[model samples]
Target: MPLAGGAVALVVTLTLWLSNMSRVPYEDALPTVGAVLALVGLAVLALRLVAGGWARAGLMSGVAAVYILYLPVAVFAVSPSAWMRGGLLLMGGVAAVLAARRIPREAPGVLAVNRKINLILVPIVIGIAGVVLLRQIDLERHRPAPDQAFAAFDGEASATSPDVWHLIFDRYGNNATLGGAYGYDNSAFLSALRKRGFAVNEEAFSNYQRTGHSVASTLNASYLDRLSSSAQAADWVPIYRSLTSSQALRFFERQGYETVFAGSWWNPTRRSGLADRNINYRAVPELGRLVLGQSAIGFALAQTGLAYGDGRGDQCRRATYKFEQLRELADEGSRKYVFAHFLVPHPPFVLNADGSCRSLAKATASSRRDNYVAQIEYANREALRLIDAILAGPRPAVIVLHSDEGPWPEPFVGDERFLGRDPVAVDWAGLNARQLAEKMGILMAIRHVDGAPAPAPASPINVYPQIINAYFSGKGVEPAPRHYVFESDAALYRFKDVTRELN
Candidate 1:
């Protein structure tokens, strides 16, 4: 009976995990599943040791009855959400399950016969359910190896190295896109970068639309086509998995640099296994919240606003914390390679130019534009302040001020659902040339040590290769052609090269 309960538990939890595989990896929930199984196994073993013959069978039957009634009822009852509410329903279910055992003796012959049949039927029902749920998982499609993805970027470690900082300002558009698409002039910011010994790529774009794929391509020193082709088409698990570790981090580690990762509230970036130190703030990990939302009790609790970890205020605070932390780390005198992905000026329009928080009044294009401008205005001041500090440090540094991807096009600027919506679900053909550039054009600025040549036609994809050749002297590799691939949101893996159309 306990063994039957174990199978039911596995089926329930794994079904939830598989349903949300886009955010949570399959291996993460395995530990919890394993613990449940272990506990059930121990309970059966102890019962066998303590009880003999019919006594053991009766005890096991009771244990099975309680578990059989408990888990599903506890998880799925009383649709509304709260910890107190879910807990009460769970206790009520247990009381009823225990009470039902006694009332069966008082009932008629039909009730006794039905009870016996149910005892036999429950295990078979659970077995069939487990088989049906297991079919959802596809084990053949695995993630690509980082080493193979970064083959062209192979290099031997150099004895002398400068502090490298790859600062990704989320959704910070290039000057061209800012002026042409958003009706905002960003020449002042670009001019400031130029004055600080930085080369701002006048024309730069990301091959992918999403942040996960863009960062993966840049750090792994290959495009998503190279990376995504290795993985199963339309499977986003590989893209998110690349965030935790990358060949870029490994290369710096090999060169005896202490790796530091400061990420946004996104789950994959919150902590990295390969980094020496992680600058994760008080923001809750998204993976935990995602898995919880899949469960019955958790789903009820979520409706009361307890399940969501996101608030516009958190977006403001976390970005501030990251900026402060990055500035502090710059002067720490360690040979550090910091990759800080800050989610600011991206959405929700929560920040003002003077560092004060503001809420959006309405979902209008004008209102969104005003709010977005204010947020980016704040980001600019912060970026300049950070750049000054990094430049003023005792040791020379190489700072790459890049954006993962450009902002949403004019069509989504006023939509509140923009952030939560699956980005690739849109009609790829709907985006105009200007809108396409607005979404894909990014800010790529590099400040190299002692005049390391800037990448020609310096797109984000070309940054690492140029850095390797100039700083690490890895190989004589030509700059990757300025080819861009646009994939339909509906068919994620299908690539359509639109370099000519954009150019």
Candidate 2:
């Protein structure tokens, strides 16, 4: 009986451990394939124990206790969801009582029996095997690989245009915002790109307000409407074992370019576990580490905002990581399409090496300006460093320093004409998830160019198609409509006919 109970415990442990190791979030109420199989093994153990004079009630009760009380607290923390919490507590209590019933009442006999239960070797062996097997499979099959499609395209266009480097400066808005709010002339940025002989898109908007949605759309050259419709929690894992995976490295695969995803951000990569193949995460090892540290701060900041899990940390980290990855991509000497996403000129404004506030509780307009200037200065420095790195590469490259969205707090922007007044603050009780995200500064995209074309009005959604049409179709297809770029408000949506205010 004890042996059988040990086996059930082993199965439960295996399921939890394996699922967590896979980094798959528990949603949809369906256990992963491995977890399901492990449960079956536990059921078999339960049957065996029941046959050998095990108290069914006690064994079941123990199972209930572990699942209800222990599992919920370990993951979700203590909450006032009493009905759910009560259910778990009940199961745990029952399991404890049932477990007690299975042991001999006599203390000595119970001690002897407990000793034997602990000595069971088979279940322990099985548990070890489960951990090793799950981890090994993840290591072997899911790493990043060269994108064949990207490679094919690279071969086809090795000499047409310089190597394309799409550098995302997280959420700096367009020229309008930069010029109006900061009072800095964008002519320097524009002039720099023109000097490098590239056409820049001054009017660009992100199809989605959030970085992951926009970045994914840009990388894939597809629309967010298509991808978001199917993105599930499991899809968020680092590995792409599931069928719904659609983060953009695959597009590069078709083009035959060696694609690398290095960043400090957490994205679908956390779930896809495909870092081994076409989406390497450790591209800029040191920068990746620093970005990760920044992400920790980003996460804490989120707790105070509306979008509970906006993936900013993931996006920020990814941006920094991608910058680091350039060195490796250059070293590989493979025709490459590198997407370097950097989260700068964005906030917490807390990541400064010198550590100072960009704005404070009583910040005046000048103080706000000072804060943003510091951030822009930092972003510009990083941007220059990245461009130098790309130019220093053996091959000629087309580097694009772009932003996903603009700054937040409409008042700091001071352009009542362009940005609307800040959204009304909700009472504490009225606060919902979306409000939090807005406060934290989502939905801003800025573009500062160095080697790319002069700025045009654009969105991230247009980036891929623009690149593909330029490089792949060779004038076969017309450019996507400028207005087709995705934009967002309280509700995230595509900008079918957005107000083109930069004029």
Candidate 3:
């Protein structure tokens, strides 16, 4: 009974944090759990001074116990009907209150058993926390030096610098995958790019299935063979570390060019310590969004205007801000290398086709393919404008535009009914070739100055190397072997190359 509140709180927080280890940071739950446990412990202590031990215990544990009881019913929010979810909330709250009331009157033997359970729980939670902390402590300690493939040239440049803009169209699918899986043709968009002097790849696919692996591979110009194939829970810490301080960025920084990074809501693409200017919008924290914000209580908070993810308003703002920055920076005539990651044409489908933000109500009810195509249309239209503005600028220009990975399968990010469920729950191993392609496909194109042919990579691993070979004077690295690998969400580091299957 003495440890019940704090024990349950720690265990619950630990569960949420562990299941989302790849997405959530190691410290995400520590402070919240500590503050909550302390608050409840102090309340119990104060109440015990004036009241009976049983009364104090029940009062102090009420909120913590409510959340525990609420977990089972949290799945109720998945139903499309709002009334069903609201009813579950009301009934769950009532049940929690009644349980608290009954706790004070429990028999001695029952209270003793409850205390025993808590005794076991508290130690187990602490041990788990201790084991995970050591690995995460040195996540950012690695500062990757330039690869020997890229080491030949001292990073020196700046003759009108031919300002470079690398843009990421998150979840933008390639032509075949868009048409084959979703029945959405993108030929006109490719034709549009051709007119803008871009050599578009109709069959481009990501080298990895997930964003972290794909991005780290692309930015570093190599595969994640360094990561163990049987990587465990804490493995993502280093992936994130490698992502922010990539070998590619180091090479850019050496060229005497200013590095500008614009980020979005997703964690891997959220920030970069190496960039001279990191552009990001005010959005809900990644931990809160991926963990608590997807909960039933988070749904309630959003309904009552207490939550921050309003129609992905911050994503719309961030993406719009990136386009605006591109317009100004392209025209500013400065020597620069800009990496702008736009999380759009992606999920939640909140950004409308006509450059407007859709209401959360409509976004929740949207058909998956229709809204995805809508966002792609919006990206196509705006990108043309940005390209035109850049081409007219005083300095020579280069644009490397591509998607990190393709559209997520509908089961992972459908309407509100599916949004709260974990992507790991989907059977990635069971996916057919087309479905795999749907997830692996991407939009890729490159442009260089003077109407010269851009040397596009077979996959993302060769992207930076090709860029270096075309522009730099020294002997550049050979393109790394191209292979598209997918791993189960359960084992993020384990690899199974599906290159032939996708072909």
Candidate 4:
């Protein structure tokens, strides 16, 4: 019984680990599997102590049968509905229990039968896990490097350099998109930015519809079309490498600028080894936190209102802390390149406009539009405050305020829920203009100490190059031409020149 239970736990762990290896670490699965095995073992032992030999053996067999069937049942189920999957699992469990009852309680060979079952299943499960681990190792070895797509800037540094602040507000929409879609006028935020000398790009759009691709493209100063052919969208290693070890950071490092990173709870931008300094609230490893949040126990606790399994309040506190840290950094007397990624105006909307924690139920139960707009109002006010402090700092600075993507549309309020859906199964043909706009429209503005406002209708990929040309002209690098490209979130590697389509 113990061996069978252990085998079940092993198989489930390996399956989940293999599926999410790109985003989750191998170590995170170990604890979850251990807990499952311990619980099942305890339950089997308790049954053995109280029940007759025949009944105990039958229950053990039934459990083993259910676990064995779970893999195929879960794999073959095509529906996204959780209830459907649960119903299928329950039916399988019922069938297994009934079949176990046919075995005699007094059978002389019952022990032998159970032993043979465990002997057969244990090796198979272990072998499967070993194979999966080997394949994952190979995938890690062959992952692409960021330097392949971007060359190091070979330009001489200017004698005088301004502090550069690149602040990303995840999923923030532009004024027109906000007004048209949510009827929320964003003029106050834009006017505030302009008052602080920011040239708000009213027509700016993200180069990619997702954060990983968008940030990767902008930071590398290149479109991902070339790399997409050779890269796998399912594997996030290449994308993360692009964000952390990009040519952009190396370029700034070469120019005698100290690199400071302020990251959110998201793994990719949470912290970087390349940064000279890091600011983050959560000390827990991101993969571990993610694993715990998605575990069965965590789900149960969340549903029962016993815990904030999603950690929305923690994220809110982290956002507040990050903003405060950025404010402190503005006073430092060094030429620094600050990259702060804030999860604001993004869901698990827990912050009111005044920065106080809102009830998690209110945040979740409210219409997606209402929660998003309120968060946006909060983000806008906080952002202006941060910008004002940075502008009043010791040195002249260049601040680029932007979003990796725009507010998600109906049926997709948060990126987590949106990305969880199978991309291939989505109906791309039915995607309308508003949906596309929601995915593409983003916020972008630049405040340079001594430069004209950036041209309207800017692409994020070109923003840094223009900055380089204006401030570090010795590099002699031409600015990337402004062009709009749209790629389906389903086919992440595919790119379409949608400049004309949107126009």
Which digits, one per residue and each the tens of the lDDT, describe model 2 over residues 392-468? 66766555556655565343334211111322332322223332223222222222223343444255655545555
lDDT of each: 0.66, 0.44, 0.67, 0.69
**TM-score: which is higher, 2 or 3?**
3
Compose the digit string of candidate 4's lDDT tens values, residues 1-503. Answer: 53665566566656766776776544434565566667666766665664466335435734653544353345235645656644554566576666655544655566666667678877989798888879677766656678877766555557676788889998899887899888898888888888777888877778766778888888888877666766655566677778877777888888889999888777677777688899988534544454444444444444454534446656778888989988988998888888988888766677877888777667657766687787898888889888888988997888899998887777644342221221233343345667767767889888887645655327788767767766776454554443343344445566665555444
Sort by lDDT, best first.
4, 3, 1, 2
Model 4 Cα displacement at 147 (Å)? 1.4
What is the lDDT, from 0 to 100, of the residue 303 in candidate 3? 63
Where does candidate 1 stray beyond 4 Å?
Answer: 1-13, 27-137, 157-159, 228-230, 283-285, 293-310, 360-366, 412-419, 422-424, 450-457
Better-scoring candidate (lDDT), 3 or 4: 4
- Clash pairs of candidate 1? 81-300, 81-301, 424-489
Q: What tens digits encode model 3's per-residue C-alpha lDDT throughout 275-367? A: 888887664445545444544556676566553534366556667777887788777756777887776776656678888876666766777
Candidate 2 Cα errors over 4 Å, as ranges: 1-162, 182-191, 224-248, 269-325, 353-372, 410-457, 473-476, 482-503
For model 2 the local lDDT of residue 157 reads: 49
Model 4's TM-score against the true structure: 0.74
Tell me the tens digit of each residue's lDDT in model 1 across 277-365: 99966544454444344444344544443424335555667778888888888788878888988776777566778887664343233
Q: What is the lDDT of candidate 1?
A: 0.66
Q: Top model by lDDT, which number?
A: 4
